[model samples]
Target chain A: MFEGREPIYQQIAEAIRGEILSGALNEGDQVMSTTQYASTYRINPATAAKAFAALESEGILRKQRGMGTFVSDGAPEQLRSSRRQSFFAERVDPLLRDADVLGIGADDLARYLLTSASDASSATNTDQNNA
Target chain B: MKANGTATIQGYGVQISDLAVRYGSTTALEGVNLDLAPGRIHGLLGRNGTGKTTLLSVLASLRQPHTGSVLVEGQAPFEHEVLMENICLIRESGDVIGDVSAADALDFVEVARPSFDREYADRLAHSFGLDLSVKPAAMSRGQRSALGATIGLASRAELTMFDEVHLGMDAPTRQKFYDELIADFAEHPRTFIISSHLISEIEPLVETVTILKNGTLLLSEEADDLRRRGVTLTGPTALVDQAAAAQTVLGHTVVGSRDLGPTRQLTLYGDLDQRSLDEAERAGLQVGPVPLQDLFIHLTDA
Candidate 1:
């Protein structure tokens, strides 16, 4: 379901950005029409249209007029870089704050992050070996 | 069916002014003014006996207003032949001929409604799993609701309203109806106003919202705009009071203190930017969004 704590339009924009970043929606590929999204998600058409307009403003999506909207050519890299910049503010700050609440120092938090990253990579390597 | 109308009529805008209705000594609606734009779904939200049905009934010409005026698609509706024909109102119950088969009832629509599309109706019936062979009175509650949805969607009138038409549907069936409504609206753009107490369920389905309380209009705005009306903060009473000092406090409710301090949660109605949210967070207060339903309940506090 597209329903969430955030506004539906913001959620819609994030979904499209996720798709673009993950390469599910390739560069220059046409996205669903507003009508299609509205019906598929059972959301208001204006909300869907609002999401599209936001993506267009961010240059992550472009319009083809009669053909409808499409993922922009530079959308993947654009989204990746933008997400990377906001990652610290939107994600890492909250993690650091939680660690601080638990009486963990910054160095200890950094150590924890390192170990978790290595553990994650090792798990992925094991899975690859199994495959 | 032979008809004397054009192929399609665009969606109609609804305008009402000083409209009032009374049932004997009781008032159902009073001095209500609303403007519903064409080609968008408007959610008419209210508690029971809030005049939602009374307003829709008047628009559909089921009854005349005791005072004032109503204009549908820019023309008066009372006894206005063609204009009345263009409006369809589907109720929660008792709109159908109970003794007739569902198919017969739909057939009746074909003859009575100049714009009825038989194939579309049949397709909708199949989609809804409607057993058209059974009489309306014999059908289950859910099936009757499905029939109501079928007619509401397939009618294709210029202005179609559903007054809690999703009442008896199960979750999946209601989702199906919502999807069908958006799809049908896309395929044939028209004005639709759905009245329901299920605010969250209908929130995403509507672009415009009209909330009623005690037979009067409370607030009417775009659904998105309405959702952005408030942010609720819960913390120490002094801190909460300080944070909400300049804002419009919709209401405040007492909450448990964190550590022997008097804590009160207050909901403020109106816009608050991200900086304000951050300020609340910095002040150690928990910030939460006020959903449309909560806003409606507060705005229509009774």
Candidate 2:
């Protein structure tokens, strides 16, 4: 039973989300059919259908009537925008308060982030070249 | 603590305390304490002999708790008309009048429950292809179960508890039940506690889970939190074991040896980042996460 700690549909949504984030599932890519997901996950078809329906509502995926569900083009961009909107209020402000408590300034954090971003971009390029 | 009659209390949830029920020397429930909130779907799960039924019976006041008090909306439920009307507990075996037909049973429900929706009941009966004239004794087990389910849903009780009521149902019918349950909840929000052994099957319908193990409440965690708290790592036995030494092993299997098989599987109650994944892969390991059932079984068994 997939009855762990969390609503089951959220888990299904996150699984598809992970695929999308990792580029395994590209925008406009056909996702698993509802029946396919149900059988693969051993869940009721209705449950799997709910998850897909939720993604459709969020505009991450769209249904094609009898054709099946497809990931909406620019879904990754939409997801990123939505997450960033929440991140500043939910995470950055708290981090800033912690920084104030620890006597860390904005300049110090900015420098650190800049260095990290450069390193990450270079690492990604190296990985792509290797692949 | 005072025993009030059922009709006087409303909006409050069901409560049980120091509840102990014993059959001879065997204790079905031992000093258990639980408070079921209203309007949310709660999941009750435990092993076959671990007293899930006993607890529900006591909460519904169908059976008296030997040593403690049970309350529905702050009133005793046994023989209490108002509270009984607001509560429906569907046991594993359908609880219906054996001599009465399905239609008669629905009529009885209409008299008993103030919130009973006649149209909904009729629709459900028709959808299930249940004959209103057929007595409970004549119907198949699945049909009998459906009759009970239909009554439970259409009753519109403030608190509804289904204890594996769909066990006799076929896959398609069961799926229909699951969807209808949610659809009903959407139209009218109420407290629903569903107990079933098929965790993966009905996982989507549950909001929170109360896990029981060997008669003790093991954990009551939000489903999402549990999913985020664990992972599965498989690879070389030595490396996998070493990595998982500091964590809990929910389950494991011998997929293969050093070169060809999955040497070990580890479940950790925390997140593993890409770096951790890379480290594991470098050590010739495969990493994943445990599903809910695996997590439940592992946690309960321990």
Candidate 3:
């Protein structure tokens, strides 16, 4: 669902990018048409089309003459690299700054992250063992 | 029922060229020009008595322009039966005749509008939780509005318009109507103009937004572009002022401030570059968005 902030089209583009990078959508997979996206999400078709156009410009999606839009061959890789570049600025940097304000050092955060990761793997292992 | 009749206007493009309407000395609309493409939902937004109804009435051929003209599907829609038949305009009361039951009113559309489909009307009515057996006079305002919505949608004219069609419906009902409209439009695909004071209610549903101010065309643009006309910047007063100094600030206020530091939120109108936004963000300022309603109010304020 789209919130009204920062234009819905931009969010749509970001969402498609996320989907491609997360492997939910594979390269060469036919994505939803603009109208289909609009109907499914209940957003304006124009907004949906604008997002698709943006994706096309970024070489993420391609539109065939008769057929619908398909994820470009290098879409997932392209998105991954682009997202990787921004991940530090948009996500990691903010978290690090917030932790700094809370008087949490980088080493402490790293230690916490290690503990969280071990806990997650152990939880998965327990599920597998139970199964 | 003019079934085997004349022209069937296939396209739903609307062109209002210098459309001006007046009721005697009182000027209703002046030199209003708008170009609405085929099969797009347009939101006609305006303040009270800002000629929203006048524009729609002119398009519906309910009242002719005293000075200008309106073209739907490349021809003027005056007494042109073919064009008129292809256009359905439902006003705020949902256009249901008071004397008849909702079912009868819908059935009447089937007789009058060659494009009206009874099964579709029934389905929409059921989805809207409307009882077809209830007369418009006896039905609640919400039910009547739902019936009107059902009729307007089921008619499926090449150009179907609803003027404040959500009149007395609750928030959830209006939302349901919008959802239904989106689903139906995807399947049918026609030009739909919805006039409403509730800009946010219809903003997401529309592709194009035509705003009227004091009976004149203020601005018309795609809703996607129109919604970006304003941006909100929130930060410390000094930094916010420095960043917003060169921009056109429509409104600004101090949302949070201490004796030592004052944090301000500035609503800026017009285009802004990404570089400026990045600079502001780097200065520890949070960039936000102006809601459609706020923008409309700001743009239309005297």
Candidate 4:
């Protein structure tokens, strides 16, 4: 369940963040306790606790004093915003670099993005209509 | 039994200072000083003949250190009645009554170890598919290992050590054993020292890691810290060399580099700061983590 290359705690934190971003976990919903994470992932509880601590420090999760850890209020929005802040550097810059390496011009990339964006929106609309 | 009456018995911490042990004329361990914090799963790693078993034996009171003091939870474990009971060491050979039935072995441990839980042991045995009617001597090697694992888990000793006990079990059985260990540890928080050659298998389960090299302590660190300590860089040879110049390169040759051409990969053993990471990224050098298993091999290479 965990990759060996990076720290398990960091991976766990990223997983929870991904869950929040994907709407799998909602604000105010109680996340799995460290014990649950430990058993499910076959990892040490301390490692899970460390992940929770990192999330807590980032206000992505909050502990309710003996009850359990819950997704912080507006956690999804916070995560989305932070991800939005890094999107250009983490996503677009790499895309641009790859395009440059492929000898693709900026205009061509722009045209491709414009077409892809419309296609993605139309796909979303079709899914909404099906729902 | 007095300790068992308590709902929660915290695991014992260990303090070893200037410890040395000798077997006949050969010295097994020397100048060893280590402090293991309580209530964490620690991975003891080493190659063959590196005093891993010797250190565990000393901790379990099976053998006394010839030179220095060894303390468990504050008091010396050697010859101490209560401390000895709290410290259980399960070896790869499965330390149980071979002649007695598997059920009877549990009964024996229940009598000797105050913390032994019969109900839990029964449940574990069922999960491991260990037949209680069969004697350990009659069981296969894997079954014997399962029996040993059952005793170790059910013992619930404050400080439990498994000295390569999982080596006998096959892959799926080892997986089950690790899962059970994590689950049980969650319910009952205690110190665990697992010494095994399967570094990658146990990497996720250990909070702290201690590596021994030929009768001496090589490195003792938090598992997470150790993971971050070794970084790998792979890219253009000039870029990789430039990035590695500022860091502590682990070895002379690149780990997986072939042909010594335009691209090269180097393993470095040290913490890489954020600035250096950003620099490596800008330079088009791919920075990756070194697995604990690889790091162990590199550090313990003859």
TM-score of chain A of each: 0.74, 0.70, 0.80, 0.82
Candidate 2 lDDT (Cα, 0 to 1): 0.74
Q: Over all chains combined, what TM-score does candidate 3 have?
A: 0.84
**Which candidate number maximizes lDDT?**
4
Candidate 2 regions off by >4 Å?
A: A1-131, B1-12, B228-230, B236-239, B246-263, B268-286
Residue ranges of candidate 1 with Cα displaced over 4 Å: A1-6, A65-68, A111-131, B1-10, B234-267, B271-274, B281-286
lDDT for A80 in candidate 1 is: 74
* Over 4 Å off, model 3: A24-36, A56-74, A89-131, B1-11, B246-261
List TM-scores for all candidates, in order. Answer: 0.85, 0.66, 0.84, 0.92
Backbone clashes, each candidate:
0, 12, 0, 0
Q: Could you tell me the TM-score of candidate 2? A: 0.66
**lDDT per residue as tens, model 1, A1-131:** 55444678999999999888766898889999998898778788878999999999999899986788999888887887888987876678777767787899989878878999999989867854763
Model 1 chain A, TM-score vs. native: 0.74
Q: Which tens-of-lDDT digit does each residue in B185-215 have in candidate 2?
A: 6556678888999987666567667887666
- Candidate 1 lDDT by residue in tens digits, B1-302: 22334555458899999999999999999999999998889999999899999999999999999998999988889898887667899999526778999999999988877877889889988988888999989987778888888888887888999998888888888888888888888777789999988888888888888988999988788876777666777888888877776443434332212334587777777665556567766656777767788888777765
lDDT minimum window of 10 residues, candidate 3 chain B: B251-260
**For residues B1-302, could you state the per-residue lDDT of candidate 3 as single tens digits?**
32233553334899888888999999999999889998789889999999998888988889999887789988999999988988999888677788888878887889989888899899888988888888899988888888889888988889999998889988988988888888778766778999998887787788888899999999999876766666777877888888876453534332222333487777777776656777787657787777788888878886
User: What is the RMSD, in Å, between candidate 4 and the native fold over all Cα?
Assistant: 3.0
Model 3 docking grade:
acceptable
What 10-residue stretch in candidate 2 chain B is worst by lDDT?
A: B1-10
Model 4 chain B poorest ten-residue lDDT run = B250-259
